[model samples]
Target: MKKFAEIDSINIKKNPFVVGSAVNPNKPEYTIYLLIKDDYLFIVDCGYFTNKRTKVSKWLTYQLEMPKAGLPWIVNTIENKFFKLSHEGGLPKDVYHYAEVVDGEKLMIDRPMFLGTRENPEPGYEIHTNSRKEGRTPKSLNFTDSFLFEHGLFDLFKDVAQKIESGEFS
Candidate 1:
């Protein structure tokens, strides 16, 4: 089995384009992304920021098992949202954790959104009260989608970790 270092490199692609004609009363939702192999479009994160009643959301799931021999590379993408707040970049343990997991990886790209987890208790959000008071604004942003990145995913992680521990890398 080859190590992460013994792998080829891949690049992320980016480009800018306008959505629609001016004064059309419809504007396209802008996005950022990284181009990986296999034409797999792993959208980082995207949504409307300016004045608009419309929005777009993205969610995906895949259970990709490593090859019996080994993986070509292990990519731990860091979503761009994390960089919006730079306070934790100073934490030693956070730095250590990322370093330990990466172990000199084949690639780490931060395109539209970062593609990995954060090491903190996320300041959670609840909106029943806000909507109750402010007439329920239709346009709001929820970065972490509930159905996609389920908070109830701890058990699943444990199961995967257990499999890895048992050398069940299929």
Candidate 2:
């Protein structure tokens, strides 16, 4: 049972779009924001220090619609940017837990048997170096899985603007 990095602070605010936030307990100065903007879902991973503040450590934008093969197309547009940021060397590496607020209820999806777990996971692909550990392991990182899980909810609201534009749904 490895000890994974826990989410120290988390705040979520909802409006026409949902903004979900998670702070790394291992690194208090670092945070990740998952937002739904228009037809796309974005993951903005940022880091800041006393001397210098980073603009955007990592930014990933994924299309809301599913592919023809019935798969979510989540892509990390910003590549290797997070590596340059200052941290304990293992940033997202320590953060592997995930949670979501649905219908005004906060749901915990951190278990390994959940939808976004190793045994029964979500539909998509991820590029991670470490294997999924039983508990929160420093070497076990699941940032990609966490993003995809949140994106699943974001996808539900993505077509609203488009449908409104076409006057199909009001």
Candidate 3:
């Protein structure tokens, strides 16, 4: 892989359109906001600010994004990003341990949901919860695609895509 000398050299566009959003069922404290800019799709984590709701100040706070590629590409990018973050001491040691064993590329992406694994035999997606105290271990929660969809994730993405086609998002 080639490395860019500067972040701006990547040529990312600004003012990404907010497409959709969904709150995690297993962990309601965090919400996933969908955004898009040309060739990029952003699955952002907007942490809780108010009771059972998220504040705009928290949008894109997690800084997670990927090219509008296939499912394999998305999963692989997510795993690779976390792997790099772990090495940089940005994530907990336990997450790195899980990341080592869970190969995102190998996970089944036929289902539309976040993908990952915990200590269990079955593969699933992982979400990290922030601890109020500094230096506390972030809690990792795992859930399936069906679970997320049951809680409105599927509808969120679908509605946004429809809106975009109708020029409602522009």
Provide C-alpha RMSD values for all models, in order. 17.3, 17.8, 13.0
* lDDT value, candidate 1, whole model: 0.24
Q: Give the runs in model 1 whose Cα sits over 4 Å from its true position.
A: 1-52, 55-97, 101-121, 124-150
Candidate 2, pairs of clashing residues:
3-136, 4-136
lDDT of 2 at 107: 24
For candidate 1, the per-residue lDDT at 40 reads 21
Off by over 4 Å in 2: 1-18, 52-170
| lDDT (Cα) of model 3 | 0.43
Q: Candidate 3, clashing residue pairs? A: 116-124
Error of 1 at 100 (Å): 2.5
What TM-score fits each model?
0.24, 0.26, 0.39
Angstrom error of the Cα, residue 159, model 1: value is 1.0
Structure candidate 1, residue pairs in collision: 77-115, 78-114, 78-115, 79-113, 79-114, 79-115, 80-113, 80-114
Candidate 2 minimal-lDDT segment of 10 residues? 65-74
Encode model 3's per-residue lDDT on 1-170: one tens digit a residue: 11112122122233346555667655566666666666544556555444335434322235333333322243443445433565664445544322221222121222214343333233345543222112574433344664444677646655665555555544
Q: Backbone clashes per model, in order? A: 8, 2, 1
Best by lDDT: 3
Ranking by lDDT: 3, 2, 1
lDDT (tens digit, per residue) of candidate 2 on 66-141: 1111112112111222223335332255343333332232222222323344554543222221223335531222
